[model samples]
Target: MAYRKVHQIIQSHSSADGDGVRIQRVHGFDNPHFSPFLMIDELKSVSPDDYVGGFPPHPHRGIETLTYMLSGHFQHKDHMGNVGELRDGGAQWMSAGNGVIHSEMPMMTDGQLHGFQIWINLPAVKKKDPAQYHDFQTEVIAEKTLPDHSLVRVIAGDLTIKGDTVTGPLQQTGVPLTVADWRTQGAANISACLNPEYQTMVYVYKGTITIGGKHIEQGQLALLSEGEGLAMAASDAAGVLLLSGTPINEPVVHYGPFVMNSMDEINQAIEDYQNGTLV
Candidate 1:
């Protein structure tokens, strides 16, 4: 298999979203190579003051959102009567197709509050489709244990190692995507492969890891060049998130929480949201 090279490294910038909730904004509305995948927000806070005020109600269109909780609790409620509670190690996926109004509120008062929220864009063909939601508790999500006591959790894609396979819970529709988290123990290496044509990148969340001969530390993202597979080695205990997607190669116009093909579409989205049709 041809191994990809780390072409670019991006450091996260701190930003606030969801009603004063602070987070490390990794990538949003930037980096075209990460197409189909728009944003990656890392929320890690131990103080209740940093995460208490949650998103009350918001409208999103022409995109999909995935929230994975590491140590905190998040409750998701939508206008469609879907209520999902995400605790530690749990995840929630929402497809805001044509449009949807929802809110994600943190339920933790104290202790460790950490997780990630990822935004994936929808192609023009599927932008007008209906919205959907998929919620997964901690135990229901698929996970794999490597020989080195490392762990890999599949959130929306299938992963296989040494003839053992684990498939994620969510079945996506547009521009087939893969999102998984990998944890490696000291000096442990794991083998992984992806489609050569797909846009692939890795985000280091904890500790340090080496990918394509490049050392990546926490709070940084490594954008990989075209390749089929690679070995992810950790000098110390490390955790990383693997993200890849099939490119749509279409014009992406993003405004606030809406992503569409053109300015006209963006305007239409705004009109829909303003008219209370975004549900």
Candidate 2:
């Protein structure tokens, strides 16, 4: 086992959406080959005015999307006749197996809207499965508090804290990928010894962190490689999300929002979407 340091750091900023949404792409744009994990985007809004209208209905395919809300509320509707609302600390995991049209809008309320959307690529075989949705309220998520009061929420995968497996919305996948949201305070440090066989990355939401003596601030993304574990310490209170997964070694044929193994597959997806066969 080897200890690997953060390989890259990039800051996020607001785009042209006129909304207060800032995106920090941890691994998608730079390293396209990081399989199982396609994209990571952090959205932060101070008030409803900043993100009221929300993202309109859109289509997705060949991916599983995880939406974790830290604060505020969101209502979602999909073409599958599914509708749900999530408050603070809630999450939604949707598998856009074949295709799905959905939209997420912030409820008209008082405070802010903050959350993260992580895109995980599907294996070649599972890409054509029927679309599905899973929603988990904050209370339903498994949480573990460390001796120092650091809290961790297991979103996907097995997490053992102090010799006990913390339970949450667990998704069992043969491909080997996991995501956890961690919040800590004081001079606390939380470390995880990840399997070197998998690739890992971390995105900071608030506060600052020191990894391998390098400091990463809010809105920054860190990509790690060739490591057994990650040693991270917070200078002040902080929140971060850690994602790890095994790489899919197959050829990735990606076009726009659809990902497949071959050009013909991409064409088929397009034709299906156009022919109303994919919903």
Which parts of model 1 are misplaced by more than 4 Å?
none
For each of the candidates, the C-alpha root-mean-square deviation to the true structure, in angstroms, is 1.3, 2.5
User: 245 in model 1: Cα distance from truth in Å?
Assistant: 1.4
Candidate 1, residues 1-279, lDDT tens digits: the string is: 798889899998899987899999876475687876888999999888887889889999999999998888999999889998898999999989998999999866357888999989898889989999989998988998888899999988766666566789876757787788998777688887776778888899999899867899999998888887767899889989988888878888889999999999999999988888766
Q: Estimate each model's TM-score.
A: 0.96, 0.89
Q: Quote the positional error of residue 175 for candidate 1 in Å.
A: 2.3
- C-alpha lDDT of all candidate models, in order: 0.86, 0.77
lDDT value, residue 21 of candidate 1:
96
After aligning candidate 1 to the native by TM-score, how far in Å is the CA of 179 from where it should be? 1.0
- Residue 236 local lDDT, model 2: 77
